[model samples]
Target: MKVALFGLGYVGCVSAGCFARAGHDVYGVDVNPVKVEILRSGKSPIVEKDVGELIAAAVEAGRLHATTSASEAVHATQVSLICVGTPSHPNGSLDLRYIYRVAEEIGAALRHRDAYHVVVIRSTVMPGTAAEVARILETQTGRKQGEGFGVVVNPEFLREGSAVSDFVEPPFTLLGGEHERALDVVAQLYADVDAPIVRAETRVAEMVKYANNVYHAAKITFANEVGNVCKALGIDSHKVMEIFCMDEKLNVSAAYLKPGFAFGGSCLPKDLRALTFRAKDLDIPVPMLESLIASNALQIRRVVDQLLRWKARKLGFLGLSFKGGTDDLRESPIVEVVETMIGKGYDVRIYDANVSLARLFGANKEYIEKEIPHIERLMCKTMDEVLEHADVIVIGNRSSEFAAALGRLRPEQRALDLVRLLDEPPESERYEGICW
Candidate 1:
């Protein structure tokens, strides 16, 4: 396969070299003549581990080349991967000039060619970028997308200094677009690569990189704040983290990462309160940790606010088990939300795949009956029954069936999402989120 890689910067150069090394004929394209000349001379323009050697090897083997003409690059390769930089502007919005310019160039190039081409965007962009790019291509080429040409968003996750290895062994590969044929073509290009391939819509693929990087940054800040607090208290933060990491059950793990009801389990809510209290006692501020509870409560408030704003007379909740797979409803924050809404005089219906009224005979049942006795009356036999009864739907868990049921929402009904359901919700009568 002949591949055209746009932007000969760090990501582009590494991608070009690695793809070429993988037996694909790769052409590096860029607006900068200096980078083009350097790559043409079998030298890499960027400093990265093993990238220069790979480029040198590929160039020597006649499997790679460099060019400044976007049209020439597009014409030479069957698949074109846009690896241009999407740097920030003054106001912190993405400077998509590079993306738009490259898309126009690719579109113009396609106008003169008769053969079907696959354009894959490897640049980091916001949710609507891929569709915008496809629209640009269609307007310029005077032909419809997924018909005359193929367009897809395939975001790259390579980190600096380790791009070559990351390319070869990525944690996962994401492909997004509407065209199944184009998806198959793009997937086959990576058939030799060892990574799980996730197929989604264009927006979801565009947002994946942002979500991943933001979470990574959040993790770093959280650890640093924890370390700072420990240092102020004269505790060994490293030893604490080491022991914390050992517990696959919860701390320093993926336990709390899932999108669900705001965390309100016995340990998390109580421990956070205790930690923040300790921080206050020591006069050491932990804003990030402190913000955790505030942020979580904000999510709950948003759910309540949306329901109120929708004027929903009756609310139907599809899951009550804190999560779908668990039976523990002990400190489930959602129970509080439901109880509060019921207290506000809104009728509520609930269903959980794993929760049974008979199973809740002991403390759990007493807790629910006392705090949210309305739940016992509102509980339904099945999900379909819940869906049938309410004016509004609230998905509080990551149940696979709930995710699937999003498409079944009525035109006049509203969905308040705590967990992101569909990548891009269709424009319906009503749909809202705690966060996008």
Candidate 2:
């Protein structure tokens, strides 16, 4: 396979070197003559581990070529990989001038060629960028996306320190495009590499890069805040984190990563509040820690606001507990929502299999009688009674039975699912999700 890689900067140089090393004929295109001359002399244009050797070997083996001309690079290759830089503006918006320029150059080159060319975006861009690139190609070449050219978002996940290994041994190869033929081209380019090729929506592929980087930044900031509090208390931050990471079932794994309603239970909200309060008392500002409560409040409010807009007078709750199969209603976020709706003069019917058991013969009976007598007054026995009495059904937790209740909903009744009640969400006019 022949590849035309634009931009000979950090990502460009590393990608060009690695792809060529993997036995592909790589033509690296750049506007800078210095980088081109450097690569032309059988040397890497950038300083990276194992990249210089790869470029040298590939060039010596007559597989790698570098030039300042896009025409030459495009004409020499079957597909183009845009590895251009998308810098930030002063207002923090993405500067896509370089990306658009490369798209134009590739489009102009494709006009003269008869072969269907696939354009792979290897830069870190925001969602909808690939669609815009495809539009640019269409305008320049006077052809539709699948006919003459196609765009596929193949976001790079290379950390600066270990870029060579990262390129060849990524966790997975994510290719996003509607056209299978274009997606297959990008996948085949990584066929020699050891990673699963994930074909997803173009917008999802583009946004995953931002999601990954922002999460990494958050993790680092969280550790720093934790370290600050630990140092002030004369505790070993490293040791605390080491022990924390050892809880593979909950802490260092995909436990609460899914997009759901506000988190509330016996432990998380209480522990997070106490930690943030203590950190504040120590004069160590942990904004990330303190912001969780405020963020959680907003998520709870978002559901209420959306419900109010629908003007649904009678609402049904599928699960009353913060989590399913637990009788504990202490600090459940949905309880607050229920209280708010009742205060707003809305008719509410609640049913939770676990809470019903707690109300009858469980330990939560005394607390339920003393604390939430109003919420307990509205409790129903079965899910069917709640579904029959309400205009909008709200699934507050993953109770498993709530999924079946969704199937039995009447045409007039709409369901607002806070927890994703289905493995694959239902596509219907009456069905809605808090976050999908």
Candidate 3:
């Protein structure tokens, strides 16, 4: 396969050399004459672990070349990979001028080609950018996408230091394309690479890089915060984290990562507060840890604002406890939201199978009495009674019973889901998610 990769930065230089090493003829394209000259002279433009030697080898073997001519590269290759830089704007948004410029050049080059070409975006971009690239190509080439040309988004997961090895052995290869022919072409390019090939939706594929980088950043911050707390307490943070990582079922795993309402439980809230308070008393400011409670409170406010926007006079809550299968209401975020709604003069009714006013005891019962004085009056006997009493239903907990309630809602009935009880949101417009 002949390939034209735009942008001779780290990603492009490494990718050009690696692909050429894999027996595919790769042509490097860029606006910088020095970078192009260096590539054309069998040398790498960027410094990495093994990219220099790899490019020298590929160039000496007559499998690689660099040029500033987009037309020449397009005429020689069947697929064009866009590896241009997407730097941040002044306002922190992605500056896509370079990407759009490369797209325009590729679109113009596609005007003279008679065969179908696959335009693959190998840069990190926001969602819907693949469609934007396809639209640009169609406008410039006077040809339709999926007919004369197509676009595929294939994000790169290569780290800077280990780019060469990462490319040779990636965690997985993801390809998102609307046309089967284009997807097949891109898939074949990575056939020699040892990784599972995943076919995902175009938008999801585009957002994968952001998710990976954000998670990596969050992990680093969390570890540093834990280390700070440990240092203040005269304990070894590394040893503590070593034990924490051993629990694969919860810590260092995908246990509590999901898009939904605020977290609330007897242990989590109490432990978090204890840690933050300890950090405060020690004269150490853990901003990330300190923001957790505030962030959780903001989520509760978001649900209340959504309900207020609907202007629904009567509201129903499917679950009242912090979580399902538990009668504990101590520090439950849903209880706070319910108290706010009732205080604002909205008629509220709640039904939790596990929570009973007559059976309340200990801290759980005492907590609700202080939060909402007349807790017994707000409680409902069954789900049907709550549904019939309110026009808007709020799914506040992940309960098995409320999973099918959205499907049974009437056309005029509205549902605000703080917890995603269903596998996915309902198709009706009346259904709304707290955060999606």
Candidate 4:
């Protein structure tokens, strides 16, 4: 495969050199003449472990070259990887000037080229950036995507210091686009790389980088805050965290990673409230911990807002359980949302594959009867029945069936999703998620 990389910065340089070393013919393109000259002379413009040697070897073997001309690179390569920078603006939004400029250059280059080229975006962009880039390319080149040409968002997860190693052994490789041919071409390029490939829509691929980085940042802040709390309490923070991490069964891990309803269970809500209350009593302000409940409520409010904005009256809810694969309804945060909507006189129905009225005759039944009797009355016999009767649908659980239900929704019927159902949202008249 002949590859053209349209940036000679950190990600671009490493990726070009590494791919060249992997035996693919790689051409590095950049606006900077100095960077192009350095790469053309069998040297890397950016410093990284093993990158300089790798670039030297690939260049010496005649597998790698660099050019300032986008047209030359596009003409010589079957696939082009856009590795341009997307820095932040003053308001913290993405400044996509570089992305748009590089895309226009690529599109203009494609106008003269007859081959069906695959343009892979390896830039850290916002959700809609890939689609925007594709639109720009298509409009400029007078070519249709997935037909005259192809586009994909194959985000790079290479860390700066250990980028070479991360590239060779990535945790996962994500390819995003609707084009099957484009996916295949990109997949085959990294077929030798030892990592699981996750194919999704271009927007999802673009947003995954933001999600990963933000989560990492959140984890660091959370740990530091916990350490601060421990210091205030005269407790050993490291020892606490060490013990906390040991509970992989419940804590410091995937226990909270699943996307479902807003967290409201006896343990989470009650414990969070207790901890915050305790912190208040101690006169120790823990904003991070205190914000957890507020954040959770905000997510719930977002769902409510979506449904209300759509003016959905006959609303159907799939899964009453806090999460699917469980029958526990105690303190389910969605119960509050449902109850609130019911109080406002919206005809609501519910269908939980796991929860049946017959199964809930003990304490659970008594609790529901006393606390949320309206919900029990709204419960439907089947998912199909709920879909048949409702004007809107709310997917609040991570059930496997919810994915299939997305296709079954009518154009006018809105879906307010709390759990991310499809890897990409369906192209429908009405579909929304609280957070995507």
Best by TM-score: 2
lDDT of each: 0.85, 0.93, 0.89, 0.86
Give the deviation of candidate 4 from the true structure as CA RMSD: 4.5
- lDDT tens string, model 3, 1-436? 9999999999999999899999999989999999999998988899999999999999999999899988889889999999999999989999888888888898999898898899999999999888889889999999899877889999999999999999999989999877889999999999899899998889989988899999998889989998999999999999999999999999977888888899987888889999999999988888998788899889989999999999988999998888887878777888888888888999999999888643455346765666566655789888998888888999988887998788778778899988777776777779998876
Task: Please identify which of the two predictions, 1 or 4, would achieve the higher lDDT against the true structure.
Answer: 4
Residue-by-residue lDDT tens digits, candidate 1, 261-358: 58776678889999999989988888999999998888788778778888888899877766667656777767777888998998888877666654
Q: How does candidate 4 fare on TM-score?
A: 0.80
- Residue-level lDDT of model 2, residues 1-436, one tens digit each, is 9999999999998998889878899999999999999999998878889999999998999988989999899998889999999999999999999999999999999999999899999999999999999999999999999997779999999999799999999999999999998998889899899999999999999989999999999999999999999999999999999999999999888898999899998999999989988988999999998888999999999999988988999999989899888989999999999999999999999999999999989999998899999999899998889999999999999877889999999989999999898889999879889977
Clashing pairs in 4: none
Judged by lDDT relative to the true structure, which candidate is superior, 1 or 3? 3
lDDT-best of 2 and 4: 2
> Would you list the clashing residue pairs of candidate 1?
none
Error of 4 at 68 (Å): 1.9
Best by lDDT: 2
> How many residue pairs clash per model?
0, 0, 0, 0
- The TM-scores of all predictions, comma-separated, are 0.82, 0.98, 0.96, 0.80
lDDT of 3 at 234: 100
In model 3, which range of ten residues has the least summed lDDT?
A: 357-366
Clashes of 3: 0
lDDT of 4 at 79: 96
RMSDs, each prediction? 4.6, 1.1, 1.8, 4.5
